[model samples]
Target: MIKRILLVTRGCAPDEFVPAWRAAMGAAVTAPPDVRPSRVTAGIVLDEVTPEPRHDAVGQEWFDDEEHLSRYESWLASPASAAVDELFGRAVERDATDIVVTGEHVLRGAPWFERRWRDGGEGLKHMALATRAAGLTQAEFFDRWRNRAGLVGAVPIPEVARGQAYLQNHPLPKAAGDWPYDAVNEVYFDDLDDLRERIAWFAENLAGNEDDLVRESWFVAVREEVLWPEATSAGEGLLPGRPGGRGTS
Candidate 1:
């Protein structure tokens, strides 16, 4: 599958922008089922943090492959699809917004996620915008970051026990050298406490390796709202469903 995510720093207030953004995205993704996105969710900024968090919201979409995404984006360029996004603007700050096309690697992935969050599968999400350490090339950074799976043994990653799902998303390079971060990582937890534990674990166990691999990391937290596919919801016993972000299992 192909994953595309848009990170936005809000210009319009959340109360006004959230719904408008979701509505516009819903309207724009009206492709044939084969090409339609399998997952779509809006991750609204959850806290007020330092450096002001480059993004206030995250719009994520998934498709079958590059071909499916191309077809869907081609449709998005059409007047009708374009019209649907007319309201999305102003809500998204033009300069702060970034759209990234990434290649994902699931470290610790699970099918059964115990429901600790009250409002459906909507839980605490953590995004780390990680930069490469010192002199390492992008290829070198990716190699060090991904190849550690072997050293970790049977478990996908150390923090898997605390986080329900853990993924590492590395952006494909561009000729312009515009996108700055080395990796955009995602972690969804049962709740804030679990998220805390996960962070603490990272700081304790992998701090050295992290220091060697990532020179800097800007972190953002979000409360996800699954806006598409009106259904029971994701996870067992939450709503009858397949998970899409905050969607299903």
Candidate 2:
């Protein structure tokens, strides 16, 4: 499977997109085939909590293969794409990669949604996008990360809600032939102060040790803005009766 990450910037205010977003999400939960890309097996939208240039939200979409993704691209060029385009503006940046490695620690709760932004509690997400050092093969890099995975989880951070790491199969896309990142790690916290503290802790404890594996890293923070098919609790899971199943219609 291939995953596509789209960095979306709004063309209008949050109020303007709320109705559209609600409508789209309602359809996604009830009749996903009507609203989602035909080949999208699963997806989620993440709004950035930390300020950044050009993008406000991050969209993750999973496709079965390149053919599926190409078909979706064709749809983007068609007349039917206007409504979403008007709301989300254009994708300022995009990346496609194969998931080479993934690890998650649920901690006290699991990820859940509450159908609307206002109804859900806010949380901060920390993301680190990085590239491997020169001469490090993909295997070697992933091996090192996997070995240190437990150490990463052991960091004493009381504010963390959930955390995950994703190792991409290849470097991220670049226009000038300079690809600085190859992987992304994400952690969610209940508050901004906690997020800041965690970063400072990482800098003091892990930065030098990580240098052998990563040549560069960029960090960003985001808030959990909204969730569809609202749930009353964290363990309600992504879909009823599906357990961790991909939300495919």
Candidate 3:
């Protein structure tokens, strides 16, 4: 499981920005060890400046469990948190126009839809993306999928401690002719440590499971507090160059 996911703000990041970001990342790495921090998943900084800032910071962290995530959140709420606050706070105060931050246990379901699409169905292709948000627990989700659908695949992130497991459908062919639909089930964990244990267990146990399930996936663990703001359709609030589009540079 990912412990802390940090979403730093950067509008026009070039190769030069990596060193600065790395320095900021080091701040997180140095936080007090009682947090029992493990791994951090740093996403490439995305640029989308609006008139006013709005969009949650996006990043991933793998922790051992739900308890760890909760403990990390406490430091975030406490004013005595750590130098991380000072480090990020100074950076944002000097560079960010505006910023907002929040944290929560997350469930991610990413099922690929592969296969040829029929000619006229191109316009409705976006509908296939709906499954990425399904929130399902471990036992029920996997059992249902295994018995009903003959699908064979592995869990996406097996490193997290407490989370649901199941296979996502990836439709192949890609054109308009094949039926395409994907499935997702996300079960939240208490913290990063819990996630780590679950992932390890899944990896070891997967080998002995039936052949029609995912047995070769590797789980990743990450931990790090983050920064972000509210998000709307076009970038932050609206689409630039459109009738009602609104956002920053």
Candidate 4:
């Protein structure tokens, strides 16, 4: 599938932000240049995570293939884009938001909306983004990126090796435009403490691995909400509070 990840920060209170964000997406699914995503997931950034000094939430949407992706991109750049932006502009810190189209590789469990990240939701999510190494092409970078994943280190990079959920997103050279990052790695944890432990483990054991596969990295934590295709059967649990609200459960 063709996936697009949106990193953004809240601009208002949770009450206002959640609803607005949901409404915008509800309309986005069927509106405009006739593009519709098969899946949509929203992640509310956790303050405890000390995000990359910018975005707080991560959003994901998936389409069928490159053709659909290209049409969606064209729609995003057209004058009609204003109407699209205005739909949920007030819900987030617009200027700080970033978007990228990628090819998603699911490396772990499914994404769910069972708990509020703050209230100890199903799991807190960590997103590690990076660029391909200086001398390697995207192909070579992706090939060697997981080399250390099976190494015999005591403190393994849980996010890379094992986790509640892991998604390796590679930014398409043409689809992602002039973006600096080439990959967005997502992993889920039990809580803040678990997140810290895993992060520390990576620093002590796997930081050096990046030197050969990636250029730099940025991390963020978020509480997610499964907005579309509501959990019905695949996920563990559904959002239990406000209709569009996440974590309230």
Candidate 5:
């Protein structure tokens, strides 16, 4: 019954942070009510944004969890997540990842989405993606999640070259809009039939539109989440799932 989300914004410039913050905050104001209900809790963490040695920039996020992820999911899927997504687009150099936890909702979260750089390089990408619907056992879920998170260590991936290509080039590229890609996405559904239908629509409807700049894309469903009990207890106010920033761990 807890939802965790990690939004890593890669390849960002120092100047862009303020603008990105504004855009993200602005979107929060206009987000749809259905996607994210009122029960969720959120926060942001500014950590190191480099790969170490060279010390470059990495990803970040607008919010983290506070034992109210189900509520957060309601807000995320609601117009709010979308609004936050749009604001982030302006500030982020490439992309972000969204991790959600559910209690009452039919489905849960752990979907990862990356953004492409200005020059068409994969700006951001998902390192690991898993969910309850994906058939993850309880042990398997937490193990993989922790393993991936611990691997990054302190430095974050600042450029697209450091991230996985699937973040940018998946089955299709997602169109940028006022909402966050992870929120308002058709990926999370309890009904297998509904999930199948949506997937089919993307494949079939996306075939002829190769030339189109903005095409419908693929968003996977995440099944489970893991939280840092220490983070909350410490009151550091750090955002979960996001990587280190320029000077942070």
Candidate 6:
């Protein structure tokens, strides 16, 4: 599967753009002559809580393969071109990659909700883009990540609700520009303080290890706005009163 990551900057304010973007996506998902390519399996939208450069939001879409992604691109250039262009304006940054490894030891209680993000209630989501150290083979890097994942799970940071890690499978297409990093790490927290604490813990524990696995890392804070069918299934245990449900603290 291939996942496309888009960072978008809006010409208008959130009050205006969010609703319009949602409507457009709703149309893409439910309306006739489906604008979304059949190959698309899942997708999510995220608003950056901490602003960076010209970006305000992030979008993720999962597809079956390169062929499917190509078809989707063609659709974007043709049928959905005008609508998207009008909604998003001209500035947008994007990247595509295959997921090599993923783990979510702690499950989030509620399905991601746009309202929570808009209101600043659900804390912050951290996205980390990084590259492997020189002389590190793909196999070795994956093994280290796999091993480290267990430690991440065992640490038990109450503030963190969910997490995932991804490794790029190959060089991304040139249309999106050069792929600067090989891996992506994502984590959710109840607040910026919690996120900072988690980072400090990582620096003390994971980062000090002899492996020196990551060569570079960049962090961003975002509010997640997820779309796609799997989100419902994933929310099964996320109800307010459910055991291990999300903590309000």
- In terms of TM-score, the best-performing candidate is 1
How many angstroms is residue 88 displaced in model 1 relative to the true structure, after the best TM-score fit?
Answer: 1.8
2 or 6, which is superior by lDDT?
Answer: 6
The runs of at least 3 residues in candidate 1 whose Cα sits more than 4 Å from the true structure, single-residue gaps closed, are: 48-51, 113-121, 149-161, 199-209, 230-249
Once superposed on the true structure, which residue ranges of model 6 sit more than 4 Å away at CA? 9-55, 90-124, 137-140, 150-177, 189-196, 203-211, 229-249
Model 1: per-residue Cα lDDT over 126-147, one tens digit each: 7888778899988898888777
Sort order, lDDT high to low: 1, 4, 6, 2, 3, 5
Poorest stretch of ten by lDDT in candidate 2 = 37-46
lDDT of 5 by residue, 97-197 (tens): 44232222212222332111111111121122222223544444434333433122233323321222222101111234312222211122334344345
Per-model TM values vs. the true structure: 0.75, 0.54, 0.33, 0.74, 0.28, 0.55
Q: Please, what's the RMSD in Å of model 1?
A: 6.1
Clashes of each: 5, 2, 68, 1, 39, 1
- Tens digit per residue, CA lDDT, model 3, 28-79: 4443454534444233322231122232222334446667755666765676
lDDT of each: 0.64, 0.45, 0.34, 0.64, 0.30, 0.46
Using TM-score, rank the candidates from best to worst.
1, 4, 6, 2, 3, 5
User: Which regions in candidate 5 have their CA more than 4 angstroms from the true location?
Assistant: 1-4, 32-35, 39-85, 93-136, 139-249
lDDT of 4 by residue, 28-101 (tens): 45434345566667677776655344576778888889888777777767775555567567777878778888
Colliding pairs, model 6: 109-238
**C-alpha RMSD (angstroms) for model 2:** 8.6
> Can you list the residue pairs that collide in candidate 1?
232-239, 234-248, 243-248, 243-249, 244-248
Instruction: For candidate 5, report its TM-score.
Output: 0.28
